[model samples]
Target: MAENRSILVVGLGRFGSAVATTLDSMGQDVLAVDKDPLLVNRWSSSIPTVQADMTDVLAIEQLNAADFDTAVVAIGDSVEASVITAGNLLDAGISDIWAKSVSKEHARILQRIGARHIVNAETDAGNRIGHLVSGNYLDYIELEGEYNVVKIHTPTYLIGYTIGDAKVLERYGITVVGIKSPGHEFEYGSSNLVMHRNDELIIMGKQDQIDRFIKG
Candidate 1:
Protein backbone atom coordinates (compact mmCIF):
# COMPACT_ATOMS: atom_id res chain seq x y z
CA MET A 1 0.00 0.00 0.00
CA ALA A 2 1.07 3.58 -0.63
CA GLU A 3 1.84 5.85 2.32
CA ASN A 4 -0.83 8.38 3.23
CA ARG A 5 0.01 12.06 2.78
CA SER A 6 -1.15 15.40 4.17
CA ILE A 7 -2.55 17.72 1.49
CA LEU A 8 -3.81 21.31 1.59
CA VAL A 9 -6.50 22.10 -0.98
CA VAL A 10 -7.44 25.76 -1.52
CA GLY A 11 -10.77 26.61 -3.16
CA LEU A 12 -14.17 24.90 -2.88
CA GLY A 13 -15.40 25.01 -6.45
CA ARG A 14 -16.18 21.85 -8.38
CA PHE A 15 -12.56 20.99 -9.14
CA GLY A 16 -11.37 21.86 -5.65
CA SER A 17 -14.11 19.87 -3.89
CA ALA A 18 -13.43 16.84 -6.10
CA VAL A 19 -9.71 16.91 -5.37
CA ALA A 20 -10.22 17.19 -1.61
CA THR A 21 -12.81 14.43 -1.43
CA THR A 22 -10.82 12.09 -3.66
CA LEU A 23 -7.67 12.60 -1.62
CA ASP A 24 -9.59 11.97 1.60
CA SER A 25 -11.01 8.75 0.16
CA MET A 26 -7.49 7.66 -0.72
CA GLY A 27 -6.52 7.91 2.97
CA GLN A 28 -4.76 11.22 2.70
CA ASP A 29 -5.09 13.83 5.42
CA VAL A 30 -6.71 16.72 3.59
CA LEU A 31 -7.48 20.20 4.87
CA ALA A 32 -9.92 21.94 2.53
CA VAL A 33 -10.06 25.76 2.54
CA ASP A 34 -12.33 28.28 0.86
CA LYS A 35 -13.44 31.88 1.23
CA ASP A 36 -17.17 31.17 0.97
CA PRO A 37 -18.87 30.11 4.17
CA LEU A 38 -21.49 28.13 2.28
CA LEU A 39 -18.87 26.23 0.31
CA VAL A 40 -16.96 25.45 3.45
CA ASN A 41 -20.11 24.45 5.29
CA ARG A 42 -21.20 22.15 2.48
CA TRP A 43 -18.05 20.07 2.76
CA SER A 44 -17.20 20.49 6.44
CA SER A 45 -18.99 17.27 7.39
CA SER A 46 -17.16 15.37 4.68
CA ILE A 47 -13.64 16.62 5.31
CA PRO A 48 -11.71 19.08 7.46
CA THR A 49 -12.63 22.62 6.41
CA VAL A 50 -11.21 26.07 7.09
CA GLN A 51 -12.99 29.18 5.81
CA ALA A 52 -10.35 31.68 4.73
CA ASP A 53 -9.44 33.94 1.81
CA MET A 54 -6.63 31.98 0.22
CA THR A 55 -5.50 35.03 -1.77
CA ASP A 56 -4.37 36.55 1.49
CA VAL A 57 -0.84 35.41 2.30
CA LEU A 58 -1.55 35.81 6.02
CA ALA A 59 -4.44 33.39 5.75
CA ILE A 60 -2.19 30.81 4.07
CA GLU A 61 0.38 31.32 6.80
CA GLN A 62 -2.31 30.87 9.45
CA LEU A 63 -3.24 27.53 7.90
CA ASN A 64 0.40 26.39 8.16
CA ALA A 65 0.51 25.47 4.48
CA ALA A 66 4.17 24.39 4.56
CA ASP A 67 3.42 21.47 6.85
CA PHE A 68 1.42 19.62 4.20
CA ASP A 69 3.28 17.37 1.81
CA THR A 70 1.45 18.93 -1.16
CA ALA A 71 -1.00 21.72 -2.01
CA VAL A 72 -3.46 22.25 -4.84
CA VAL A 73 -4.90 25.57 -6.06
CA ALA A 74 -8.21 24.85 -7.78
CA ILE A 75 -9.71 28.31 -8.06
CA GLY A 76 -10.61 28.17 -11.74
CA ASP A 77 -13.25 30.90 -12.02
CA SER A 78 -10.86 33.71 -11.22
CA VAL A 79 -7.28 33.69 -12.52
CA GLU A 80 -6.31 36.40 -10.07
CA ALA A 81 -7.44 34.40 -7.05
CA SER A 82 -5.78 31.27 -8.40
CA VAL A 83 -2.43 32.93 -9.03
CA ILE A 84 -2.45 34.73 -5.70
CA THR A 85 -3.30 31.57 -3.81
CA ALA A 86 -0.56 29.62 -5.58
CA GLY A 87 1.99 32.35 -4.95
CA ASN A 88 1.04 32.42 -1.28
CA LEU A 89 1.54 28.66 -1.07
CA LEU A 90 4.98 29.08 -2.62
CA ASP A 91 5.78 31.81 -0.11
CA ALA A 92 4.77 29.37 2.63
CA GLY A 93 7.46 26.99 1.24
CA ILE A 94 5.20 24.19 0.01
CA SER A 95 7.47 22.63 -2.62
CA ASP A 96 4.92 20.48 -4.46
CA ILE A 97 2.16 22.76 -5.72
CA TRP A 98 -0.44 21.86 -8.37
CA ALA A 99 -2.66 24.53 -9.87
CA LYS A 100 -5.66 24.30 -12.20
CA SER A 101 -5.35 26.40 -15.33
CA VAL A 102 -8.34 27.67 -17.29
CA SER A 103 -6.31 28.48 -20.39
CA LYS A 104 -2.88 28.25 -21.96
CA GLU A 105 -1.94 31.70 -20.63
CA HIS A 106 -3.11 30.73 -17.15
CA ALA A 107 -0.98 27.56 -17.30
CA ARG A 108 2.10 29.55 -18.32
CA ILE A 109 1.52 31.97 -15.45
CA LEU A 110 1.30 29.09 -12.98
CA GLN A 111 4.50 27.54 -14.38
CA ARG A 112 6.31 30.88 -14.11
CA ILE A 113 5.07 31.20 -10.50
CA GLY A 114 6.88 27.90 -9.71
CA ALA A 115 3.95 25.52 -9.57
CA ARG A 116 5.32 21.98 -9.97
CA HIS A 117 2.29 20.72 -11.92
CA ILE A 118 -0.44 22.46 -13.91
CA VAL A 119 -3.75 20.69 -14.47
CA ASN A 120 -5.53 21.79 -17.66
CA ALA A 121 -8.54 19.57 -17.19
CA GLU A 122 -10.63 20.80 -20.10
CA THR A 123 -7.85 20.58 -22.66
CA ASP A 124 -6.74 17.17 -21.48
CA ALA A 125 -10.30 15.81 -21.61
CA GLY A 126 -10.74 17.10 -25.12
CA ASN A 127 -7.57 15.38 -26.30
CA ARG A 128 -8.55 12.10 -24.69
CA ILE A 129 -12.02 12.25 -26.23
CA GLY A 130 -10.56 12.90 -29.68
CA HIS A 131 -8.48 9.75 -29.45
CA LEU A 132 -11.30 7.60 -28.08
CA VAL A 133 -13.69 8.73 -30.80
CA SER A 134 -11.43 7.21 -33.46
CA GLY A 135 -12.36 3.68 -32.27
CA ASN A 136 -8.83 2.33 -32.81
CA TYR A 137 -7.59 2.49 -29.24
CA LEU A 138 -9.10 1.50 -25.92
CA ASP A 139 -6.88 4.02 -24.19
CA TYR A 140 -4.23 6.54 -25.23
CA ILE A 141 -1.47 8.51 -23.59
CA GLU A 142 0.44 11.29 -25.30
CA LEU A 143 4.11 11.45 -24.38
CA GLU A 144 6.84 14.02 -24.89
CA GLY A 145 7.48 15.13 -28.52
CA GLU A 146 6.05 12.77 -31.15
CA TYR A 147 5.76 9.67 -28.99
CA ASN A 148 2.50 8.06 -27.84
CA VAL A 149 1.40 4.96 -25.95
CA VAL A 150 -1.86 3.14 -26.62
CA LYS A 151 -3.74 0.08 -25.44
CA ILE A 152 -5.49 -1.67 -28.30
CA HIS A 153 -6.66 -5.08 -29.43
CA THR A 154 -4.31 -7.09 -31.60
CA PRO A 155 -4.98 -6.11 -35.18
CA THR A 156 -6.89 -8.78 -37.15
CA TYR A 157 -4.18 -9.28 -39.77
CA LEU A 158 -1.57 -10.13 -37.16
CA ILE A 159 -3.76 -12.35 -34.97
CA GLY A 160 -2.03 -15.71 -35.71
CA TYR A 161 1.57 -14.59 -36.24
CA THR A 162 4.43 -14.41 -33.77
CA ILE A 163 6.15 -11.05 -33.26
CA GLY A 164 9.36 -12.39 -34.85
CA ASP A 165 7.57 -13.77 -37.92
CA ALA A 166 5.62 -10.52 -38.42
CA LYS A 167 8.75 -8.37 -38.07
CA VAL A 168 6.67 -5.93 -35.96
CA LEU A 169 9.37 -3.34 -35.35
CA GLU A 170 11.04 -3.63 -38.73
CA ARG A 171 7.74 -3.50 -40.62
CA TYR A 172 5.79 -0.91 -38.62
CA GLY A 173 8.33 1.00 -36.53
CA ILE A 174 6.18 0.43 -33.42
CA THR A 175 6.89 -1.75 -30.41
CA VAL A 176 4.55 -4.05 -28.54
CA VAL A 177 5.87 -3.60 -25.04
CA GLY A 178 3.22 -5.57 -23.13
CA ILE A 179 0.38 -7.99 -23.74
CA LYS A 180 -2.76 -8.95 -21.84
CA SER A 181 -4.58 -12.15 -22.74
CA PRO A 182 -8.28 -12.13 -21.96
CA GLY A 183 -8.62 -13.48 -18.36
CA HIS A 184 -4.90 -13.54 -17.71
CA GLU A 185 -2.35 -11.10 -16.25
CA PHE A 186 -0.31 -8.81 -18.48
CA GLU A 187 3.13 -10.03 -19.59
CA TYR A 188 6.12 -8.49 -21.31
CA GLY A 189 6.05 -8.71 -25.10
CA SER A 190 8.86 -10.97 -26.27
CA SER A 191 9.85 -11.35 -29.91
CA ASN A 192 8.77 -15.02 -29.90
CA LEU A 193 5.38 -14.21 -28.33
CA VAL A 194 2.49 -15.28 -30.50
CA MET A 195 -0.33 -12.82 -31.14
CA HIS A 196 -3.74 -14.24 -30.25
CA ARG A 197 -7.20 -12.94 -31.00
CA ASN A 198 -8.79 -11.04 -28.08
CA ASP A 199 -5.35 -10.25 -26.69
CA GLU A 200 -4.72 -6.59 -25.95
CA LEU A 201 -1.40 -4.92 -26.64
CA ILE A 202 0.27 -1.95 -25.07
CA ILE A 203 2.06 -0.30 -27.99
CA MET A 204 4.56 2.53 -28.00
CA GLY A 205 5.78 4.54 -30.97
CA LYS A 206 5.38 7.77 -32.92
CA GLN A 207 1.73 8.62 -33.55
CA ASP A 208 2.00 8.14 -37.33
CA GLN A 209 3.57 4.71 -36.97
CA ILE A 210 0.93 3.59 -34.52
CA ASP A 211 -1.80 4.85 -36.83
CA ARG A 212 -0.38 2.96 -39.80
CA PHE A 213 0.13 -0.17 -37.72
CA ILE A 214 -3.46 -0.05 -36.55
CA LYS A 215 -4.68 0.35 -40.13
CA GLY A 216 -2.85 -2.85 -41.12
Candidate 2:
Protein backbone atom coordinates (compact mmCIF):
# COMPACT_ATOMS: atom_id res chain seq x y z
CA MET A 1 0.00 0.00 0.00
CA ALA A 2 2.85 2.35 0.77
CA GLU A 3 4.79 3.26 -2.34
CA ASN A 4 7.83 4.14 -0.28
CA ARG A 5 8.02 0.60 1.17
CA SER A 6 10.57 -1.68 -0.45
CA ILE A 7 9.73 -5.21 -1.68
CA LEU A 8 11.92 -8.30 -2.06
CA VAL A 9 10.79 -10.47 -4.95
CA VAL A 10 12.22 -14.01 -4.98
CA GLY A 11 12.42 -16.02 -8.20
CA LEU A 12 12.34 -14.65 -11.78
CA GLY A 13 9.90 -16.98 -13.42
CA ARG A 14 6.91 -15.68 -15.38
CA PHE A 15 4.85 -15.12 -12.28
CA GLY A 16 7.77 -13.58 -10.43
CA SER A 17 8.60 -11.22 -13.30
CA ALA A 18 4.99 -10.08 -13.64
CA VAL A 19 4.59 -9.41 -9.93
CA ALA A 20 7.86 -7.48 -9.73
CA THR A 21 7.00 -5.43 -12.78
CA THR A 22 3.54 -4.65 -11.43
CA LEU A 23 4.85 -3.46 -8.09
CA ASP A 24 7.54 -1.38 -9.69
CA SER A 25 4.98 0.25 -11.98
CA MET A 26 3.09 1.17 -8.81
CA GLY A 27 6.23 3.01 -7.58
CA GLN A 28 7.38 0.49 -4.97
CA ASP A 29 11.10 -0.20 -4.59
CA VAL A 30 11.81 -3.84 -5.54
CA LEU A 31 14.80 -6.18 -5.37
CA ALA A 32 14.23 -9.06 -7.76
CA VAL A 33 16.30 -12.19 -7.15
CA ASP A 34 16.77 -15.36 -9.19
CA LYS A 35 19.26 -18.23 -9.29
CA ASP A 36 19.84 -17.96 -13.03
CA PRO A 37 22.42 -15.37 -14.04
CA LEU A 38 20.56 -14.64 -17.26
CA LEU A 39 17.39 -13.93 -15.36
CA VAL A 40 19.09 -11.37 -13.19
CA ASN A 41 20.66 -9.68 -16.23
CA ARG A 42 17.41 -9.72 -18.18
CA TRP A 43 15.57 -7.72 -15.56
CA SER A 44 18.50 -5.64 -14.34
CA SER A 45 17.17 -2.27 -15.47
CA SER A 46 13.53 -3.24 -15.03
CA ILE A 47 14.14 -3.57 -11.30
CA PRO A 48 17.11 -4.27 -9.06
CA THR A 49 17.91 -8.00 -9.54
CA VAL A 50 20.21 -10.35 -7.66
CA GLN A 51 21.33 -13.83 -8.70
CA ALA A 52 21.24 -16.28 -5.80
CA ASP A 53 19.67 -19.59 -4.96
CA MET A 54 16.96 -18.71 -2.45
CA THR A 55 17.01 -22.17 -0.91
CA ASP A 56 20.64 -21.77 0.06
CA VAL A 57 20.98 -20.65 3.65
CA LEU A 58 24.13 -18.71 2.77
CA ALA A 59 22.36 -16.84 -0.03
CA ILE A 60 19.54 -15.74 2.25
CA GLU A 61 21.97 -14.94 5.05
CA GLN A 62 24.17 -12.84 2.72
CA LEU A 63 21.23 -10.54 2.03
CA ASN A 64 19.94 -7.92 4.44
CA ALA A 65 16.35 -9.08 4.91
CA ALA A 66 15.81 -6.35 7.45
CA ASP A 67 16.02 -3.76 4.67
CA PHE A 68 12.97 -5.10 2.89
CA ASP A 69 9.51 -4.07 4.04
CA THR A 70 7.79 -7.03 2.35
CA ALA A 71 8.66 -10.27 0.49
CA VAL A 72 6.88 -12.09 -2.32
CA VAL A 73 7.65 -15.76 -3.00
CA ALA A 74 6.78 -16.33 -6.65
CA ILE A 75 8.72 -19.52 -7.25
CA GLY A 76 6.93 -21.93 -9.59
CA ASP A 77 7.15 -25.66 -10.46
CA SER A 78 9.05 -26.68 -7.30
CA VAL A 79 6.71 -26.47 -4.37
CA GLU A 80 9.53 -27.40 -2.01
CA ALA A 81 11.59 -24.38 -3.00
CA SER A 82 8.54 -22.17 -2.86
CA VAL A 83 7.72 -23.33 0.66
CA ILE A 84 11.36 -23.13 1.68
CA THR A 85 11.70 -19.59 0.38
CA ALA A 86 8.62 -18.54 2.28
CA GLY A 87 9.97 -20.15 5.43
CA ASN A 88 13.38 -18.60 4.97
CA LEU A 89 11.91 -15.14 4.56
CA LEU A 90 9.82 -15.66 7.68
CA ASP A 91 12.85 -16.80 9.67
CA ALA A 92 14.77 -13.78 8.43
CA GLY A 93 12.10 -11.63 10.17
CA ILE A 94 10.25 -10.50 7.07
CA SER A 95 6.79 -10.40 8.62
CA ASP A 96 4.72 -10.01 5.41
CA ILE A 97 5.40 -12.73 2.86
CA TRP A 98 2.99 -13.36 0.00
CA ALA A 99 3.32 -16.73 -1.75
CA LYS A 100 2.08 -18.14 -5.01
CA SER A 101 0.85 -21.73 -4.59
CA VAL A 102 0.60 -24.56 -7.13
CA SER A 103 -1.71 -26.91 -5.29
CA LYS A 104 -3.71 -27.57 -2.14
CA GLU A 105 -0.69 -29.12 -0.46
CA HIS A 106 1.46 -26.18 -1.49
CA ALA A 107 -1.07 -23.71 -0.10
CA ARG A 108 -1.22 -25.55 3.21
CA ILE A 109 2.56 -25.68 3.49
CA LEU A 110 2.92 -22.00 2.68
CA GLN A 111 0.43 -21.16 5.42
CA ARG A 112 2.34 -23.34 7.89
CA ILE A 113 5.53 -21.51 7.01
CA GLY A 114 4.04 -18.13 8.09
CA ALA A 115 3.05 -16.82 4.66
CA ARG A 116 0.64 -13.96 5.32
CA HIS A 117 -1.19 -14.40 2.03
CA ILE A 118 -1.46 -17.10 -0.63
CA VAL A 119 -2.58 -16.54 -4.21
CA ASN A 120 -3.75 -19.53 -6.23
CA ALA A 121 -4.76 -18.80 -9.82
CA GLU A 122 -6.44 -22.18 -10.31
CA THR A 123 -8.64 -22.14 -7.23
CA ASP A 124 -9.90 -18.62 -7.94
CA ALA A 125 -10.95 -19.60 -11.45
CA GLY A 126 -12.70 -22.72 -10.18
CA ASN A 127 -14.67 -20.61 -7.72
CA ARG A 128 -15.71 -18.28 -10.53
CA ILE A 129 -16.91 -21.21 -12.68
CA GLY A 130 -19.22 -22.34 -9.89
CA HIS A 131 -20.77 -18.87 -9.71
CA LEU A 132 -21.25 -18.55 -13.52
CA VAL A 133 -23.35 -21.73 -13.68
CA SER A 134 -25.39 -20.93 -10.59
CA GLY A 135 -27.73 -18.96 -12.87
CA ASN A 136 -27.73 -16.35 -15.62
CA TYR A 137 -25.50 -14.77 -13.00
CA LEU A 138 -22.80 -12.33 -14.02
CA ASP A 139 -20.79 -13.17 -10.93
CA TYR A 140 -21.17 -14.07 -7.26
CA ILE A 141 -18.91 -14.07 -4.23
CA GLU A 142 -19.66 -15.82 -0.98
CA LEU A 143 -19.16 -13.43 1.90
CA GLU A 144 -19.28 -16.41 4.24
CA GLY A 145 -21.25 -19.63 4.69
CA GLU A 146 -24.35 -17.64 5.61
CA TYR A 147 -24.63 -15.15 2.70
CA ASN A 148 -23.54 -14.12 -0.78
CA VAL A 149 -23.10 -10.83 -2.63
CA VAL A 150 -23.56 -11.05 -6.38
CA LYS A 151 -23.41 -8.96 -9.55
CA ILE A 152 -26.00 -9.50 -12.25
CA HIS A 153 -26.09 -7.60 -15.55
CA THR A 154 -29.45 -5.96 -15.88
CA PRO A 155 -31.54 -7.58 -18.61
CA THR A 156 -32.73 -5.11 -21.25
CA TYR A 157 -36.27 -5.21 -19.86
CA LEU A 158 -35.16 -4.33 -16.33
CA ILE A 159 -33.22 -1.18 -17.24
CA GLY A 160 -34.20 2.47 -16.49
CA TYR A 161 -35.35 2.02 -12.88
CA THR A 162 -34.11 3.29 -9.51
CA ILE A 163 -32.51 0.74 -7.14
CA GLY A 164 -35.43 0.95 -4.69
CA ASP A 165 -38.13 1.21 -7.35
CA ALA A 166 -36.87 -1.94 -9.12
CA LYS A 167 -38.50 -4.08 -6.42
CA VAL A 168 -36.08 -6.88 -7.32
CA LEU A 169 -35.67 -7.90 -3.69
CA GLU A 170 -39.41 -8.46 -3.17
CA ARG A 171 -40.23 -9.77 -6.65
CA TYR A 172 -37.12 -11.87 -7.30
CA GLY A 173 -36.02 -12.60 -3.75
CA ILE A 174 -32.70 -10.84 -4.47
CA THR A 175 -31.64 -7.35 -3.43
CA VAL A 176 -30.97 -4.64 -6.02
CA VAL A 177 -27.95 -3.37 -4.20
CA GLY A 178 -25.93 -1.23 -6.65
CA ILE A 179 -25.55 -0.49 -10.34
CA LYS A 180 -22.56 -0.46 -12.67
CA SER A 181 -22.56 1.47 -15.96
CA PRO A 182 -21.11 0.30 -19.27
CA GLY A 183 -17.80 2.01 -18.53
CA HIS A 184 -17.88 1.39 -14.80
CA GLU A 185 -15.19 -0.62 -13.09
CA PHE A 186 -14.64 -1.43 -9.40
CA GLU A 187 -16.87 1.12 -7.65
CA TYR A 188 -16.53 -0.55 -4.26
CA GLY A 189 -17.88 1.88 -1.64
CA SER A 190 -20.04 3.93 -4.02
CA SER A 191 -23.01 1.67 -4.84
CA ASN A 192 -26.09 3.85 -4.54
CA LEU A 193 -26.95 4.64 -8.17
CA VAL A 194 -29.75 4.12 -10.68
CA MET A 195 -29.85 1.37 -13.30
CA HIS A 196 -29.46 1.98 -17.06
CA ARG A 197 -29.35 -0.13 -20.24
CA ASN A 198 -25.68 -1.09 -20.11
CA ASP A 199 -25.46 -0.98 -16.32
CA GLU A 200 -24.82 -3.88 -13.94
CA LEU A 201 -26.61 -4.43 -10.64
CA ILE A 202 -24.83 -5.97 -7.68
CA ILE A 203 -27.26 -7.68 -5.36
CA MET A 204 -27.13 -9.64 -2.15
CA GLY A 205 -29.32 -12.46 -0.82
CA LYS A 206 -29.45 -16.24 -0.31
CA GLN A 207 -27.63 -18.28 -2.97
CA ASP A 208 -30.78 -20.10 -4.08
CA GLN A 209 -32.63 -16.86 -4.73
CA ILE A 210 -29.61 -15.46 -6.59
CA ASP A 211 -29.62 -18.45 -8.91
CA ARG A 212 -33.32 -18.06 -9.61
CA PHE A 213 -32.98 -14.32 -10.26
CA ILE A 214 -30.22 -14.87 -12.77
CA LYS A 215 -32.15 -17.62 -14.49
CA GLY A 216 -35.29 -15.46 -14.89
TM-score of each: 0.60, 0.57
Tens-place lDDT digits, model 1, residues 44-117: 99989999998887887788888887888888889999998999899888878878899999999999989987
- Find the candidate with the highest TM-score and give its number: 1
Off by over 4 Å in 1: 123-216
- Residue-pair clash count for candidate 1: 0
lDDT of 2: 0.72
How high is the CA lDDT of each candidate model?
Answer: 0.82, 0.72
